[model samples]
Target: MGSSHSTPVAPVEFDHHLVSALADNAAIPVPSPARQSTIDAHIHARIQAELQRLREDEATVRDEMHAALEKENLDRERALAHDQDSAASSATLLADLDQVRAKVDRFHARRDLSQLPALREARDGLVVCYKNNTSTPLDCWQQVETFRASVSELEKQHIQSLQ
Candidate 1:
């Protein structure tokens, strides 16, 4: 049988605290105060610039909205003024048309008299009778009474036909 020999192993001592400290230091960055302040200032400047830009944009939008509203109000006022002018003109035109219609109605009434020669003659004769005798025309003339009775009978017949 061969003899077997084993060498004794030495115990090694490790500084765990030093290793842990080194590892902690390596994991976290520690900046100088001046550098940190400079970085903070840069960040602050960027934030302030962004805020100022946002404020300017908001003011621009507000101005645009105000201008738009003012323009709309102006347009509405113009439209209303135009409508009023048109209404005034229409009223004047309507009045003129009514006056013209009254003249036309007078002409039509004269034309209707022309169409009824007998009525026109009877009316002329009655006028003459009244002119000839002012106080006692009814007793002297029968034409006026006949014309009135005819008109009344014609109106009654027309009403009865409608019913």
Candidate 2:
């Protein structure tokens, strides 16, 4: 029941067509050309520096690997040389042993011949003792003389061989 009074609201005018046309022709925002070049230069410099560092690291690794390979080669050569030396020494020792064996065989043959004189003397003594009707012949006496002679010869030969 109060007097109904309504203030009139102003009507807002919008240019829909103009807004639509601007939207249709709108350009995408971008950095300035100079700024873009500066950014590209910075990125290129960083990449170049990183590449140089990587190259340096690769060179160092290659050098270390080469040094290690050289050391391994040196070790292998040393081992080979040592093996060769050992083989040479072993061959010499074997040759010396063979020579000693040959000398021993010669000595044994000489000793066998040296005993023949004593054996002949003993046979003669035995015949005389049997003819005289004495006790058994002293075979050991001749054997002792022959053994001493052979031993003396062998000692001389052994000394010569040693010298």
Candidate 3:
């Protein structure tokens, strides 16, 4: 705590040239409010246009899918119709086969009757018995002929039913 001496400090002063240089360096041009708004509007319009294009593309895909489904349905219907027609034709053919089978059965029956030796032996026996018998009426021979005609008629009726 000896004698204290204080030195006086000078007040700092700003240089005008430096201030002006700094102001010039820091100055930047700003866009007008209307021009900035117009740029924003343009961006918004482009975004809306893109959204609309996406919607249209979605609709087109849906329409194409619908058309494809309809075509598939038509194809299925056509296949079903073809199958029905084929089945009907097959049924008709089977019916014809049944008729032919019946006709063949009739022919086989007739051939078997023609090959029967028992019928010929019976006929020969009847002839010998009639020649030996003096009491057998003449009407008995006519009755046998009638029975043969009835058998022939029955065979003809069976053949007609097959046709």
Q: Pick the candidate with the highest lDDT.
A: 1
| Candidate 3 colliding pairs | none
| Prediction 2 TM-score vs. true | 0.36
Error of 2 at 117 (Å): 81
- Lowest summed lDDT across 10 adjacent residues in model 1 is found at 154-163
Q: What lDDT, from 0 to 1, does candidate 1 have?
A: 0.78
- lDDT against the true structure, per candidate, is 0.78, 0.74, 0.76
Considering TM-score, which of the candidate structures 1 and 2 is the better prediction for this target?
A: 1
lDDT of 3 at 158: 63
What lDDT does model 3 reach?
0.76
Alpha-carbon runs more than 4 Å astray in model 3: 1-30, 85-163
Candidate ordering by TM-score (highest first): 1, 2, 3
Which 10-residue window of candidate 3 scores lowest in summed lDDT? 113-122
Candidate 1: give the clashing pairs.
none
